[model samples]
Target: MNYKTFLINLDRSPQRLADAKKQLDALDMSFERVSAADGSQLTPEERACFDKNTAQKRYHYDLTWGEVGCYLSHLKCWQKIVDEKLDYAIILEDDLHLQDDFNKVPELLEQLKTPWSFIKLGNPFKPRKETPVETLARFNLVRYDKAPSGTCAQVVSYQGAKALLAARSLFFRPVDVDLQWQWEVPIKILGLTPYVAGHNLSFDSDIQQIDQRKNKAKRSGVRLREQLRFFYHSKLRGE
Candidate 1:
């Protein structure tokens, strides 16, 4: 399949940048690496969105917001991709690995575009049972077909891109959590099937932690509560 590859890179991580380039090169995948915060190139609208601050009092929550900020800072990157005009694209973070024969995934991409609007090739959870994937408005979550780690990678087609674009206005919160929910809940609510690679196409773990603390999120509760919204109360309140 003919597709364009896009990677989100942060200026702070030189080592990660080098590793990412090496991995993609090894896979023989052509891609474009764009900084998540190169404002000179961003649209006026993109800049304002990233500049908005919710005003948190606690530190951990502030950190969460920062992560969200970092993620949000990349909106223009996605916008640019859409503007450039492509049916679908492979989006990756600064740190991700690929299979030895990853170059042959174009065929899988073609297959993925059929049933689901979007597909995630890399998942943290491994694929076990063959659960049929449902097609959401623009993406699909299906049983593992590729690897074991079910949350390692993701694939999105034009429809998925449209979905993401539609939800773009709704992503004012944390990037990872927003992505997690968008992949799981909204996709499901919209009746899109979500799938995991079941394979290890991407990787992120404790070792990569920018803070190196387990309860960072818990510690963050006090300050970021407002940002989390009312629904989050159920988890915090344990109702």
Candidate 2:
């Protein structure tokens, strides 16, 4: 009952932010909006880095590193949560619209107490399941799997926040930069499990990007080869 909300937004998307605010207010939930471009709360070096990182990206075209700014917003919010000594918080972007009668705060807090890693709310696709999740699985293998999409609606625990921060410095590879949900890979490696469910009302649409590459669906033989190398990597690390 005592969690904070992070309303992450971009100044360019005023309409979306207003919409999300209206919906949250109707639900009686208070949130603090954080803009990545706003430098008052962030250091000059940090602001410059974000600008350098997000240089040429937009809603659908921003490359992966462009997301570093968004991740920075989440980190700032996490710090606030820790400073306030709250257990966790629900994070949102301006694009999400919640159900009119959706007040699952208690339910969400309960789930966070479990071994689960994260709970997602917003997506660009239709809901995959109708029930509130009581349990979710932590993916434990060096293999790629098709996960449910839309990570905007989420609950971030204190541990989850720390783990994400840990990933920022450690996983520096630039694969899947333009693809949303690419963060899920690091989240998975962090041993976080995502909820496979949704509520009655959510801001989801059945929109998908054009797979410009004709071979988009084809798995890069790299995945299988990478799994094989995990054994060697594991042995070298003595894992």
The true-versus-predicted C-alpha distance at residue 2 of model 2, in Å, is 2.8
Q: Model 1 compared with the native: what TM-score?
A: 0.59
Tens digit of per-residue lDDT, candidate 1, span 1-239: 44677776667667767887787897777888776653234356554553234323323333333344345544544565467766666666666666565555565555443355545555544334344454434444454322232223455556566666666653344443445443322332111123322322344531224443343444346436544643474355332
- Candidate topping TM-score: 1
lDDT of model number 2: 0.48
lDDT of the candidates, in the order given: 0.49, 0.48
Q: In the order shown, what is each candidate's alpha-carbon RMSD?
A: 7.6, 8.6
TM-score of each: 0.59, 0.56
Native-to-model Cα distance after best TM-score fit, residue 99 in candidate 2, in Å: 1.8
Off by over 4 Å in 2: 37-65, 111-113, 125-146, 170-239
Candidate 2 lDDT for residue 75 = 66
